[model samples]
Target chain A: MNEGETRKPIIVLVRPQLGENIGKAARAMLNFGLTEMRLVEPRDGWPNPSAGPAASGADIVLNRAQVYASTADAVADCAHVYATTVRKRGVTKPVVTPAEASSEIAAAQGRSAILFGPERSGLETEDVALARAILTVPINPEFGSLNLAQAVILCAYECSKHEGLVQPTQEDLLPPAPQEELDGLIAHLESMLEPKGYFRPEARAEATRRTLRGVLTKPAWNHLEVRTLRGVLSSLQREPRL
Target chain B: MNEGETRKPIIVLVRPQLGENIGKAARAMLNFGLTEMRLVEPRDGWPNPSAGPAASGADIVLNRAQVYASTADAVADCAHVYATTVRKRGVTKPVVTPAEASSEIAAAQGRSAILFGPERSGLETEDVALARAILTVPINPEFGSLNLAQAVILCAYECSKHEGLVQPTQEDLLPPAPQEELDGLIAHLESMLEPKGYFRPEARAEATRRTLRGVLTKPAWNHLEVRTLRGVLSSLQREPRL
Candidate 1:
């Protein structure tokens, strides 16, 4: 298996009633980089041509899907398995929310599977009994059922987040100027402002320098940012210093 | 100032051109911990009683807001100021998304300001010059104009998340071990596992140590858990070396 396969969660659709739902599930899985797919006794054609378009660019999942005669056969080798259900069946397995399930699944870091049952009737008692855990998404109790694909998408998002598959967030990526560049910019700025009444050379120059450095280093600077300030300082030399 | 006051961000309405926009800005600022407000050339009454209702629980921001004639005067005392604008001005200052800007502000461990431009004309060139950096919100270019309050809310949300005030929805707050303790655990784990052929005696142990450290450093285990594991190993050592 490739790195992506090992890192991602395997999505198993057990006894799905429609090809479109399967197709949409594939699309949702792909949105969050979950490509592994296992299908158990799909009511419609397993490789329906119509399912391809609905899958969008998630063709890889549809193309490489595994067909199974039973849910047991689908997840026989999975190290961890979670059954998605809305109603409680009084199963002995540990019940978990999607958030908790994702946390546990993230820690597993091995062959893990999430099983989604058919649209009309979810997994059979025997099918759910096979799971290590039962997972239920929190929704409005009055009308809580989510579409198969939407459920798949939410689960996938949670799993991807566990693996840190999301892009580098704006917060994580800082743009503070480096020490060397900042020192240069500060010196240049100080020299230019010294001639103006902005800094009193006797007592306030050091104080002003500290204040300037504090401002410059307040936020982390990125590569282009340091260079931009250097350019601005160089330009200021050609203009009025004060 | 209270501890909360010291921790929150400063919301600066720079050259804001509307009363309703200012009201909405106050509402957004209140959603997060940002209560400090500075208004620079507001088009309408800033301390206007009409702004009270719109501010919701953010009445303090409006009540204590300082009015100024120029953005420079408004932010003169602030250690770090970020000018917010929608369009890309020719000047090359470090531009950050609201999220990045917030984290930067939060980490400064001092007062940091987020500047917003007027709804009609936005900030002027000189106003942008007054700031150390620029904060930009990524929106759909076709319909880029955001409501003033919505923009403030976005900035506030980012700021709150960075300040450790808002709980993370996806991540577990794994308490970090002190440097000395973490180093000791790393050594203990290495010693315990080395005898089991986990690391070859002759090979460089740095890579193996790093991999093990990475796993242990994950949110899965706390410092106490690591200590317990060490006790388990010491007790197990009483048996056969393996």
Candidate 2:
């Protein structure tokens, strides 16, 4: 295999139930250029007919998938193994986000594999023990309901980024306003606040001015945004038209 | 609404098909803490019967989903509009990944909306024209097949990263060993190399030593790793057993 192909981490599904979900996971893997799949003791056995239709044309992933008798066997050749879990486990293994795992996997010297647990109940404690780290997706703590396929897709998507996917160009984003324009906007605002006694209390006036400057500077508003803010200040300064 | 709620981008499904898919999309959105959903003229009409069961308990999103007559009307209140497309279109709008769009939406001064096209067919030309930018997930060029729910989930997942989700801590990771330990390893390796005339040629000895140090310094191995290496060197120096 080529270096690029070898560098791609293997996706290992441990004790996955439901042929349809397996197929969905395959589809998710293929969507992000991940082709290797390893299955460990599937409940219904292999060659599940239901998986084909759900895979939606990602048959190649299913066709060449390897089956292992145990999770340890599945990751025997891999030097780095990460077990995915939704909840914080009692284990002391380092936890990482999918994005962070992808970066580490990319730089890893040897083969790397990510293990995903079954749908209903997640990975057994024994399965997690074989892994060097835990990979967790930081989701809404209140509504964390990521399915097997969704988890696979997210990990696959992040790994694809390191395979030379074209990054979205930032040319469309306008540069932050030049210093002079920002100064002008600040000066305009200060002028308005001075008359209204917004910066009153002569003893603390300097500190108040500095605080306002810090808030204005933090946004790094673009030239157009600065211009818009200037216009708003001018409008507010106008006499209300009855 | 509070600033956090206001900053969250609205997810708009334009001319969606299959009530089941709509329900799935709602589940996907709520998984990442996005509560607002807007639908524009769903194919089977609003309150689809198939949607509820497929949502998998993301009923809050489906129940609160707002239906609109047209795509334009759905995003009328938004200052920034992004239309998602799998393929590159003829439009000149800036194209961005989900992560980029999330960052922009988080920092935007006003409401932002991301539009997802229908299942079978994507956003129409008119819908593309209405958007300030195009949101595209960089997928496997050879096999691009992202279902509506998958697409929604990916975008939602990226947005959640900026919502103060507890980051996976790196406390388990050991810090790099102290410089003195690193120097000891280098010294031991150098002692072995000097006796073997590994750094031959007096003129180039300093340069070769520097190059060796560079390679060794890059990894910043921890104390345990350094100790392990020292053990390896000690083993190599042992006399071969008959």
Measured by lDDT, the strongest candidate is 2
Which structure among the candidates has the greatest TM-score? 2
Compose the digit string of candidate 2's lDDT tens values, residues A1-242. 78787778899999999999999999999999999999999999998888999999999999999999998788866767789999887655678899999987776555788999999999987777666679999888888889999999999999998896433344675545554566688788777666555555778776566545534543445666777566555654544333
* lDDT tens readout by residue for model 2, B116-144: 99999999999999999999999999889
Checking candidate 2 for backbone clashes, the offending pairs are none
lDDT of 1 by residue, A114-182 (tens): 999999888889889888999986543433435587578667756755664433223533455468876
Candidate 2 segments exceeding 4 Å error:
A165-242, B170-242
Q: What is the lDDT of residue A172 in candidate 1?
A: 35
| Per-residue lDDT over B1-242 for candidate 1, one digit per residue giving the tens place of the 0 to 100 score | 98556656678887676666676677666655566888987776556756776565566667888898877567655556687887677555666777678776665534567778877677776667556567876543333435466567667755655554542332343233333344565577556555555544447455444444433332223345446445433543342221
Supply candidate 2's per-residue lDDT for A101.
94
Report the TM-score of chain B alone for all candidates: 0.64, 0.72
TM-score of chain A of 1: 0.70
